[model samples]
Target: MSRQIQSRSYLIPIHLDENHWSLLVFNINSKQIINFDSLYNIDKNIAIISNLISILSKYVTVLKGAQNWNFFQNYSAPRQSGDIDCGVFVCQYANEVHSILNMKQFDIICFCETKIEDSYPNSFYKNDYYYKIRLDRSRHGGGLIIFIKNSFVLTKSVHPENTELIYLQFRKSGQLNNFIYTFRAPNLKEQLFLEKLEDFIHSINLNEPLFIVGNLNMDFSDKIKSNISKFADHNDLINFVKTPTSI
Candidate 1:
């Protein structure tokens, strides 16, 4: 029994730092973040209820099973977003970031981080190598991001209506199943997962603009950046950078 959806779209955020100092905000469609002056008497840790008018303004709802922050699926269905109706699907591994995020809103959610990896891809990229996407290094990092389009159309794919694609930026023989995928040994598991996710995107012939954002652990290299730009240009997707860190 899937939960009912009551909204159109919701904001989903995931912060990797385990400390409560970091925040994961969801469903704030109306307002953006505000900086408050230091309060001498108030405890910043307190989770205070916002004013009713504000609460109605799309505050956060903690979910049990969401990838990244895609757990707000309880809004509505046929589950179509975008102008042409190519369905919406989001997948990610939350264990590396948090316990779990759940709701009946997301179409496909895979918890890949908790899986076993014999070795890791860490040697290739130093821990500090910065890519816009952050993958978990401690684990084999079968961790990935994918989107599905048009989930209503029935087929052999995970989401019948949507085209699913891996945002991992791998140029291989279709994810892990390709000959090169297994060579990574312990990393094979991650490769295989990527292959499966690639299958999800192809099923729908989906070509839409998608924004894949997260702590991918893979730092940005000049070539990697160029490749990403090309893909986005080909697909009509543009990269959006949050304001850069201030001194």
Candidate 2:
């Protein structure tokens, strides 16, 4: 008889920005960086951009929250730092650079379009888009719901069978949280989407480490966006960006 094989999961967010960027590999075991990479030069466009893209090619290794921190401390992949065309970075690989990364096989889901220069990028068939996307083949602009096959899933909202996702949208005036808006402030539809997303991510547990990456478009300063980080990071779900955020 074949024995059951356990899978691991990690909640990683490769904070995507159009400005100076970075790659953070968090240890699911310790809830910290196993390795990290950031842009080397922003002033020099060509050379800097070239190096950043090359460095980003490296892959990464993912661990689970239950894995002991000491083990991760002993085993880590070399990381790279650099800038790119401004899209979502891969969160799973062996070296955090120079490796083939994939997002198509996971149970993840997300929006296909984003607000571009003047309007929502409505064309779905186009390949090159403006949002933080996981891979080049995707359309809806940018976002990823990466997962290791057979790994644990975390979330509060009901999901479609065999899908890794929950919708994160803004709260309308009729909702119960409307009162809370008077006491504080209500989150944008996108911000609320993340809050719901985080809650769903936290609802499940895992046997091994996992990494989550996508466009959160949130900052620590935004009370609403901050809430999503709170729920995920509380269980050791680490995020790469902590500074004030903007589009």
For 113-172, candidate 1 gives per-residue lDDT tens digits of 322232534442222212212223223123332222123221221222222222332222
Q: Go through the candidates in order and give the C-alpha RMSD of each one to the true structure.
A: 17.0, 14.8
Highest lDDT against the true fold, candidate: 2
Candidate 2, residues 24-69, lDDT tens digits: the string is 3444434443322333222344343333333433322333322333
Candidate 2 global CA lDDT score: 0.33
Top-TM-score candidate index: 2
Give the TM-scores of the predictions, in the order they appear. Answer: 0.26, 0.27
Give lDDT for model 1.
Answer: 0.28
Off by over 4 Å in 1: 1-102, 110-112, 116-139, 143-154, 158-226, 238-247
Candidate 1, 168: how far from true, in Å? 15
